[model samples]
Target: MTIIRSLSEVSDNYRALFVDLWGCVHDGVRPIPGAVEALRAYRKTGGRVILVTNSPRPRAGVAKQIAGFGVTEDAYDDIATSGDSARVAMFRGAVGNKVWHLGPDHDAGFFEVPAILTDPAVIERVPLEQAEGIVCTGPFDPLADPSVMRPQFLAAKTRGLKLLCANPDIVVDRGETREWCAGALAQLYTEMGGESLYFGKPHPPIYDLARRRLGAIEDIGDSSILAIGDGPLTDAAGAMGEDLDLLFISGGLGAEETGTAIGGDPDPEKLDRYLAETGVVPTYTIGTLR
Candidate 1:
């Protein structure tokens, strides 16, 4: 219930941070103001910052993309992406051998097996009719509605194929534009009688991956860690479910609901109501990372 202006107010309370990338570090197109600096300052204080993102790209790919936004390596210690988490599941045959990819061509990296897995299943991307399961990295067109995949979802439902959702985010803000994500398609598929599996935020798989990534560097416990993000459902819910303290960013996706203008604090009453309605209680609140 406490609202603060910058991350520095509580960065000393935790040994590490599980930070969301899209709305927290960058607005998809570029890094948000003061975000990169806040992370750098945290690192300078010997606090590790892990970019735990719902991005449906491998960690390396995400690094390359973030570099374009000026989110340099000095800002954070490591990254745990939804794509890498879900890719491990795919290579382990969580879906099946012949799977249909319900996403754009840019997500072809999702099929690449990780080098760490000793023996991985042979996965092939085939037509929906010839598939045993489905893998959704994202929608073919993010700006379009999710209902457009009803026809394909119906066919997949008839065959009883399991859909592995890489990114469990419904939408993300790219500059001033909001775009749909893989979670939208997975939600539609489940609603239309198809089974869908999630590996991102609010789910245990990605969190496990994040812990493993953190363990590689230092032996930290959950009590000493904090989660920071902008999304109410994904970030807030995930942090709460993991029993970790969360620093909610009101100026990102929840800006309109919380009456938070850019680079400004949110209306207390509006922020409280939004959290109550969404059922997510964070340890702290901030306008932005700084």
Candidate 2:
């Protein structure tokens, strides 16, 4: 893999780009340096940029949060969020209406389809058997250990409740810390013999949504699309699975494993081994989006 400094070096090759949000554009707390500018620059040059995020929030909600981090709407042509995909599944009767929400209040918007029981007190009052299924947005607290929810998970599992994971990200960079996400919980539940459905990167639904959004802006084929992100397991794997080229950011989630600090040159040997283990070979590698 070749490491470059910015997307501008190879932006001309793709008509539509699927850009990851959390680790690629920002670290959850602030915008990554030049990340927003790089996307805006790509758009200015006639590229259709789709902010494909594993965030559990709906597209509007994620857009609002990213704007708080200085990411302007003009930075991308559109957004496709896991929550939006999950909402589509819910609308299609994939999951029942009486759902047990297993995340924070900020993510309760995912349950806006009807009466959402967000109150912890009220939720505790209702028996686990009463809920038809579970909708997990994320952990109760991003900073806390995921094991704290094991009891609830077991209870739901015992009741044979299916889980719909909105965000399939196991972990994400939160400023200087690594925080657990809903995918971790969903994986744990599945390990304990619970059936779970995931809607995000590394899954087909979210990518399908992103491709449709990009198609609306430009009639580009998969070969003319590039997926850019920091996580190899999510972004790289997703792009490779969808048969699209990938632009892997070396300094984000795989920094420690690849021995590439943020804004630093990636250790080629380590990066190669890491990609080999994940079975994802990116078409391009950059220290950062810019």
Candidate topping lDDT: 1
Misplaced by over 4 Å in model 2 are 114-127
Q: lDDT scores for all predictions?
A: 0.93, 0.84
lDDT of 1 by residue, 1-290 (tens): 99999898988999999999988899988888999999999999999989999988999999999999999999989999999999999999999999999899988888888988999999999999999999999999999999999998998899889999999999999999999999999999899988999999989889999999999999999999999999888999999999999999999999999999888999999999999999979999998888
After superposing candidate 1, which stretches have Cα over 4 Å from the reference? none
Question: 1-290 in candidate 2: lDDT tens per residue?
Answer: 77777788888988888999988899888888889889989889988999999998888899999999888899988999999888677655565666777888888677554222232222221335678888788988888888887898889889888888999999998899898999999999999889999879989999998988888888889989989988777888888889888999888988888888766768889988888887768888987778
Cα deviation at 123, candidate 1, in Å, is 0.7
Error of 1 at 146 (Å): 0.4
